[model samples]
Target: MTSADLHTALLRPAVLQILRAAGFGHARPVVIDTATDLAARYFLLLASSTAQNAFNTHNTFVPTIQDVRLALTQAGALVPQMSTAEEGLRDAVEIEGVMVPFEDLRGVQGFVTWAQGPVNKEIRRIAGFGDDANVEEIAAGLDEQEDYLTALKKKHSKTGEESRYQGTILGKDTELQTVSIIGGPAASIAEWTQQSLSTAQTATLPDADEPATPATSGISSAPLTPIESE
Candidate 1:
């Protein structure tokens, strides 16, 4: 599938449903660009709304910085340990790797990365994990990164010009809603459902009345009719 298709697939109800299945209770899905700089851009989005959701939830959510790292872990994305956002941003700039550009995409588009380190590094390589890491890792990493950025932006308010800049970076030109507040899929709850059927069309012999097929004859069968009924 094309990168655009891949992007859309991440948000499909089926995928989000699977995430909820895997214990991510409060997953909010949003769609953004498929640019090489996805990492940095994502951080900016995270700083916007993702962070707010975290705090409003039960305090089980981690701090913004650690929350990103933990989000990587949950989504099976790679991340480096860093104590601060400043450190992370600098590292991102130095790597020259395509990541979501947090500063450029933030409220203050000019907020440059202060230094380089393990924090802002793009998830270049995730060694040892085979197969399942592909889509899930990207989705989880981006999801968490977006939340982290949102937290930062909220705590550190910016001037009107900066907000405008941030708005531009978030793609205001195309009538795009940069972020979407999404929900996880409901649980498989179909076990309790029952359906009516036409008896003539669905008729089958009672368990005792039917002869066992060769494949299943080795197993014992229960008495088809209840003793009380007899």
Candidate 2:
């Protein structure tokens, strides 16, 4: 399969995991594909909007938090939209010649609320993590598993096998050595390459004492006799 198809296929597993965490016991293949496509499109839209906003407002392609927020706002992804009455009230209440909506004042309040709410807690619980466990603990658990697997492999391996392949691609340890050309004018590859390049350049150059010959147009310089009418 093509790389794009493979990348899209890889996203399906993450989508399935999210669905499972969100209490979906089973989903059809069509459903999974649709979810993955929607997720990919949403991400692309956010990135495109963020880049445009950054370039238009800040004269830069690099997006900042403000640009991302603006993108989210433009996409209507930010929650807790201000009602007309609320907007009127907010406009009426001005602080130091500046007026800001109550919802706008609570920046990313929806995201923070969702992260701290029951839904996030349930997701964490479903993913085999405690509510209080942070990212560091999760990362450490993965590392511990990897370490255990490595130790198990070494324990099961025959003695001296690892040492025999220690300097090769099959081994874990890396080997370093200097390379030298035995019978070349220069001892090392780098020196030989430099010397060969210098010789080639010298051959192509003209001698300083030699006078330069004018280029020929490949046509006879003598005037041609006019042909008589036949």
Best by lDDT: 2
* C-alpha RMSD of each candidate structure in angstroms: 22.8, 7.8
**Model 1: per-residue Cα lDDT over 1-230, one tens digit each:** 78655545443433433344345566433422232236444554555433554565545444465454434333333333332455456634434566643332331122223112232232211222223334345546642233323444455655533565355432235454433324523222232121223444356545777787665453356546556753
lDDT of 2 by residue, 73-161 (tens): 77877766553466566644467888655446353787667766787786655554566666455666652222322444476667753
Q: Estimate each model's TM-score.
A: 0.16, 0.61
> What are the runs in model 1 whose C-alpha is more than 4 Å off?
1-41, 44-53, 56-64, 79-230
Clashes by residue pair, model 2: none
Once superposed on the true structure, which residue ranges of model 2 sit more than 4 Å away at CA? 81-103, 126-129, 135-200, 220-230
Query: Over all chains combined, what TM-score does candidate 1 have?
Result: 0.16
Q: What lDDT would each prediction earn against the true structure?
A: 0.40, 0.72
lDDT of 2 at 226: 94
> In TM-score terms, which candidate is top?
2
Model 2 alpha-carbon miss at residue 100, Å: 12
